[model samples]
Target: MREWINLPELGMIGLRAKIDTGASTSCLHASDIQPFQRDGEDWVRFTAHLGTLVQRRHRCEAPLVTVKNIKSSTGHVQSRYVIRTDMTLGDRMWPVEFTLTCRKTMRYRVLLGSKALVTGQLVVNPALTYVQDKPVLLDISGAP
Candidate 1:
């Protein structure tokens, strides 16, 4: 069932995401991406503009997994930062890998790709948008 996703770890709640099976990995819209080392572990700092109104900006940091060369729909190749974070859809919540890049031009801020939409986990109805109950917005004041 295609459903809305909540990126609690990224301080983004109830964000509409397209469940695209054609895509290999999940993607998140991020900006001001900066890489840094924290006690020998790789980390990245980024900002996410939530909602279409851009009412709130969530400043977040996550351990960097790797940089991947991802070819976009327009056939442009770009390197993106990969980060692991938790996603909640329906009654289940699990960790998912997301490639961080600026998707300002895309319709949705988040894309739930095939990698995160495992078999038996969900079934997408191409005609539907947000099949699940909307989640409450969390306190993101301390996101940074």
Candidate 2:
């Protein structure tokens, strides 16, 4: 079973997610990632291009707290973006830390780890889709 989700800035969408209780933080296939400083604080900005030429840009800047080294499911060790953001699935919303990485080769660009889906209900039927058949979610904001 599967369901539809709406991100705070991205809007309504469908994604192939693995409700793994083993992982900690959710990982997003993000690219062109760069970090900068503003007003003596730290902020990281990057592009999230789901399935289009244009990249949907998102900026996260908080008191530069911590960056952890994590290993991906594929057994690759890399540095990822860390931030606490609001994610809404069904009628529930919570804050989650999502690391930025490139998932162009994977079926689902965004991987819903156990940490984010911990409290939400689980749907395991691969043949299922999202709620209201929302258009595949995309972040169309990075085209020149």
Using Cα atoms with residue i matched to residue i, what is each candidate's TM-score against the true structure?
A: 0.87, 0.68
Window of ten residues with lowest summed lDDT in model 1: 135-144
Model 1: per-residue lDDT, tens digit, 120-142? 27776788777788877645584
Model 2: residues >4 Å from true position, as ranges?
10-18, 52-65, 119-144
Candidate 1 residue-wise lDDT at 128: 74
All models: lDDT? 0.83, 0.60
Give the candidate number with the greatest lDDT: 1
Instruction: Give me the overall lDDT of model 1.
Output: 0.83
lDDT of 2 by residue, 1-144 (tens): 344455564442444444445677777777777777888777677666464344444543333335768887799888766755666666566776777778777666566777676645544455655643543444468342
Backbone clashes counted, model 2: 4
